[model samples]
Target: MDLETVMQELEALGKERMKKMYISNGAHEPLFGVATGAMKPFSKIIKKNQPLADELYATGNYDAMYFAGVIADPMAMTEEDFERWMDGAYFYMLSDYVVAVTLAETDIAQAVADKWIASGEELKMSAGWSCYCWLLGSRKDSEFSASKLSNMLDQVANTIHHSPERTKSAMNNFIYTVGISYLPLHEKAFETAKAVGPVEMKREKKKSSILLASENIQKELDRGRLGFKRKYVRC
Candidate 1:
């Protein structure tokens, strides 16, 4: 689909309630506030249009940018394209869930994620951590190094508490990702989660509790979903 048509459709799909919710969650203006459920059918329609996704993201409209992430082919995207996407990715849903998840599917996932996590930029670092976390969910144990994973987990255990606001939240997610997705590291992740305890995040002037990594891991365990890898990081 063309950018104009997608924008028009997003406009038609948007709702005041959704817009208010996005605003409350720290999204900037120029948003259509089309719900994810509402966007799914539309996103599926454009899922293979790489050029169109690029145009949509460049528009800088919140809904369009999100749709861009939903449809873009990471394998076809250049590193420069990802950098440009990160530059405009302000909201967590856009940065972490959409951009990060899409990037995780690329051949450059590790290199990009490592660089991003180490970046001084808050959004970039958060996106990087999230990218790595989702990568764990998407890949099998045989595809990566156990020692390297352990070292990264150790690093998070030591530094997550002192990390930047969004990075801390992402780090917390990393622990949960490790706990549930990597069976051998489950004990280590549980220990790290216990060490970190509950994560505190400020949302709309209130302290919101991000689930403890151990608790989330246990929930997965109880549901018999531990060690079950996702087919893809997106969605």
Candidate 2:
């Protein structure tokens, strides 16, 4: 489908209830409030349309950008494309989940992740951390850097308290991904989680919640989902 058709479909599917939810979760204006799941069919239809994905993202509408990630051809994307997306990404949905997951499957994933993590911007840093987590989660034990990941685990344990809210949440998710996807570090990550304590996240307006890393890890372990690597991070 074309970009205009996609936007029209998104607008048709948008709901005021979803708009309030996205806003509460830090989404900006120009959003159609289309639910993530609602974008799937459209994504599948336009999955190979790189130009369409680019056009959708360029529109700067949150829902369209969200959909762009769903349809974007990560392997075909240039570093410039990734850079533009990162620069325009202003919220966690676009930065941390959409762009991060899309890039995590690419050849330059690690390079892009390292560069973004070094950024002073909260959105960039969070996206960087999230990209790293997803890449790590999808790799085999032989390809992963245990020592480096462990060191990052230690960093989160030490500095998550002082990191930006989004960065802290990404770090917490990183730790969880590490524990759940890397058996060698599962125990160590559990220890790090206990040491780091609670990960506090700001929800809509005045609401907030704490995610207990240790508890989440334990639950995954009990469910026998530990060390299960995903084939892809998208969706």
What lDDT, from 0 to 1, does candidate 1 have?
0.85
lDDT of each: 0.85, 0.86
| Residue pairs that clash (backbone atoms under 3 angstroms), model 1 | none
Candidate 2 structure quality by residue, lDDT tens digits, 37-75:
988886776666778888999999999898888888899
CA-only RMSD, every prediction: 1.4, 1.5
Report the poorest 10 consecutive residues by lDDT, candidate 2. Answer: 202-211
Best by lDDT: 2
Enumerate residue pairs that collide in model 2. none
Task: Give lDDT tens digits, candidate 1, residues 200-219.
Answer: 76555767656577788888
